[model samples]
Target: MIKEAIYHRPKDNFAYAYDKETLHIRLRSKKGDLTKVSLIYGDPYEWNDEGWKNSKKTMTLEGTDELFDIWFVEVKPKYKRMRYGFEIKSNENFLIYGEDGFIEKDPKNAHFYFCFPFLNENDVFNAPAWVKDTIWYQIFPERFANGNPLLNPKNTIPWGSTEPQFDTFFGGDLEGIINNIGHLTELGVNGIYLTPIFKAKSNHKYDTIDYMEIDPQFGDKKTFKKLIEVCHENNIRVMLDAVFNHSGFYFEPFQHVLEYQEKSKYRDWFHLRDIKVKALPEANYDTFAFTHLMPKLNTENEELKKYLLEVGKYWVEEFDIDGWRLDVANEVDHQFWRDFRKTVKSVKPDAYILGEVWHDSMPWLQGDQFDAVMNYPFTQAVVEYIAKDEINSEVFKHKLIKLLSNYPKNVNEYNFNLLGSHDTPRILTLCQDNKDKLKLLFLLQFSFIGSPCIYYGDEIGLTGEGDPSCRKCMVWDKDAQDTDLFTFLKKLIDLRKRYSAFGANGQFEVIESAKETNHIMYSKKTVEEQIIITINNSNSALKVHLPFDISKNESMNLWDNKPQKISEIEIEPLSFSIIKL
Candidate 1:
């Protein structure tokens, strides 16, 4: 046994309450070091004259990263408290491992083992239940559709006339979204995430001029209200973007600072180093990424805090919005987000609060701030293995295990997973316009554990580079669009909803395949069925052999529902199939 390789903590990711009654525990050991591990647990006070009363359950090998093999088990204690330890078995000998270190035999003293003082309901990480089961559709609203071109700004070009530029507008508005609810309904996604729709100076709407009003190009309050009513009537939930990290240069408070310099009452709202300064290059105030046009706000100021908190509450209370996707959330202080979560949930208790964080997000996901983050790590890993061919199947599996282990199980269920967004190149472009590779990427994404999102027009084979190019106007002409890609997306969405193992809250296990190094296989298990999803990312067809005997097990291919055998399987190059066993 590699004694130094064994690791576990009393709290955090290693051990935590999954819910009011269930506690999840995990252990890390050197890869393939221990042959088996059994959990010995019981109530802290459940003891007799002989010794502490306890029960033992074997732990299963969950998965492996680069250096460690994770072992996990869930226990429901008769009482709400627990004292537990591990019994590790190796080829040579068996040893007892506990808080007190290695021992020759099981200790009669319960104090020698790890302890969870209590399982309080208040400490449970409670995210919105609906979020786990939802498939989201993200819209870059200005380029989604054009219901009324009369509302277009001056110099508006024809719809999809040319590649999108930073200043070009395609005249998309709330009325346009209202006109296309059928498209969303038919696509089978239940949630819509529209990027910044508030009053703003730029076509993208991230530079907010007014936090309370809808941009004139999009529509007025009444038109937005009608849009929301219609969306809800069709059983679709709407989530708006909140850009509280900074405001547009022409915003009233910032304009007051510009006019009055040091004497303005709103001077404290911004971080200014000098009183006399102008323009982006010369401005002495802190801004968003050195762009003086979008000045960063001092959320610590009491008056500024009140204004922003009201902005958070107003949409939920007035518009009946279902959720808020915060912009530049990591740059803001944690206290402000805590208050934002409280304010939004006060209006609608089940409202989802997602943050725009691209890195490790443990700080903001403790049940008091953001429910989940953008999950960019998931995106990068997929691109590296499937699109760029920069990493092999083993490396991809290792990266995914590390990513999934970074959060609690509940947070993983609600994570906002996406392949491409307005900020990145389209999926087809990332795959070098390879249709088979794109299909494989979608299969892996929808089958993984998280809430998945699709960028608008990505379903219809939209392809472009990053930023402005990725924000092209939606293709409304059915004849001009790629019907094959559209049908593929619709069928993928239907399959995700039809399978119980694909449920957000179900069991997932990655099975390592030694026969095919370029292939990845994982299983999704529910109470009624077990499914094996295999993908071949290489150029040559790969042969896959099962690790277990399924000679008598009933099996079928999930993609086309064709019968499959349990013997060695063959996967075509850059293609995937799901087998129900």
Candidate 2:
């Protein structure tokens, strides 16, 4: 008798929506030790009166035979009833492999995959509850552009940039962002998420000096109002960064504590006594300081709550900004988010809120405070899958499939996907300045399951790394950078926008997937349209068997510049290809 296998999703001992396009399969052999195994599909099975068939040949586990304890699979079936199973024969079934709740097993007779019809093929799931399924583009104020130099930081006053002037200002402001509204619209981004523009001692403004006012260096109340008016006029929404998690030590209200120590009446706005710091910093019964200069606000303080809430309300009612993106939100009290959601939603029901958390934020996504979370999991998953060669294509596809299934059904509707962002290394660099690989990742990010965002410079193929390396001043000299990357991003962004089926609000299903040494192939379908995305990750020319049904319509290839109507097409080595029908 073939041994049976039990699949587990991340939360516990269960995997749902097997019909969804992706899945992670694992095998723990019944023997003493088996580090590896093979998963075979398309084999026919019959028992009693029932039988099933696989559409294609088997995809073998290639790269990660030992280290990876999980098998990621991307499934694109004709209907929900796809029959599949594994052939777990490693070291005569010696070792077993299953982690993160996935059960190890010996292959049983082929199992039936009861596909869920309601499952969407394009799910842009946002993990954090505070955010909505809206489009978002992260902008760095100084490097984005120069609005009014007078509003820019003054160099004469104080010491800055402990780590290579990253903390210093290069003069970009609100006017700079407002100046380029047309640029944003052309790029197809509907919402703009700006880094801190509030009154702060540093350029990054993570150390905010005043919670209520705009930085004199970032323009005044009127400049912001004008920018908001213009953005809304163009149907471009604005989401400001609220650094409430921490404030600059120099803030006037907080200054009382810094100057007067325990005697200050405003001292209770921090959590000093709660967390131990060195001698110079005061005890933050009311607030918490992440570092000496940045003091964390004590949401427990009623007085502090009133002040922050009032300021939060003022921006929505008076200035009419869309919402806030809380920085380092994980460390902030959950009660604060609870109050924030109540207060902010009272002002603007559809107002979008986001949190800057970097891990599995399931606790926060339960619909209390945030509408969405910054999806680092998607970014890191794809990156590590491809770049690190940590997981094989089939295994990677399994991870991809489980990501959508493991979360709430609606979360698939609003995930914020990105190839690169302000804080991480650029995608172009990760691809080693290779345009083909970058193009493939770009298509996957946009087409997969999220409202994909092109980090300001990433679309233009700006190659940089680390904190300040990725954050370079936008080259006004458009001709000075990588134009091929720019054009591809533009077209890809438009493709997602034109087809609702491809955007954040649509359904997603991985159609066909194959992972080999040098190449990979996967296709996704939406109700209104279907697209086949392919990538050749190797340096040498590689051929991959596309396991998708191209018979629905005349498939058109967009990767070759002009759309080519063809029965079949091959993706060039080191290139990414997309087909829309």
For all candidates in order, the CA lDDT equals 0.88, 0.63
lDDT of 1 by residue, 1-581 (tens): 89899998877777888999999888889998999999989998988997998889999888888999888889998888999999998888698888988887888779889999899987778888888778899998899988887788788888899998889988988889999999999888899999999998899999999999999999889999998999899888999998888999989999988888878999889888887646555678888998989999999998999999999899999999999999999999999999988988999999999999999998888888988899999999999999888888889999898888778787888899999999999999999999888988888888888889999998888999999999999999999888888788888788788886865655778886432557888888888888888889888988887665777877888788877776588888888778888
lDDT of 1: 0.88
Q: Using TM-score as the measure, which candidate wins?
A: 1
Give the range where candidate 2 is weakest over 10 consecutive residues by summed lDDT: 156-165
lDDT of 2 by residue, 1-581 (tens): 12343333332212223324543333322222333444434333333334343332333332222223333344444443334444344444432223322234423334433222233433222233333334567898867778666655666222122222475567777898898888778776778888888888776788888878888877889889999999989887888888777778788867776567767787678766632333354443434333567767787799988888887788988988887888888987888888988798788877777788788776666566677677888888788766555766666665665566445545555667777777788777887777776777777787776666677867676777777777777765677767777777778777776665555645555444556554555555656677666666666665544554556656677555465445466655667667676
Stretches off by above 4 angstroms in model 2 are: 1-135, 156-164, 274-290, 387-391, 511-515, 548-552, 559-567
For residue 241, give model 1's deviation from the true position in Å: 0.6
RMSD of 1: 2.0
| C-alpha RMSD by candidate, in order | 2.0, 8.7
Residue-pair clashes per candidate: 0, 52
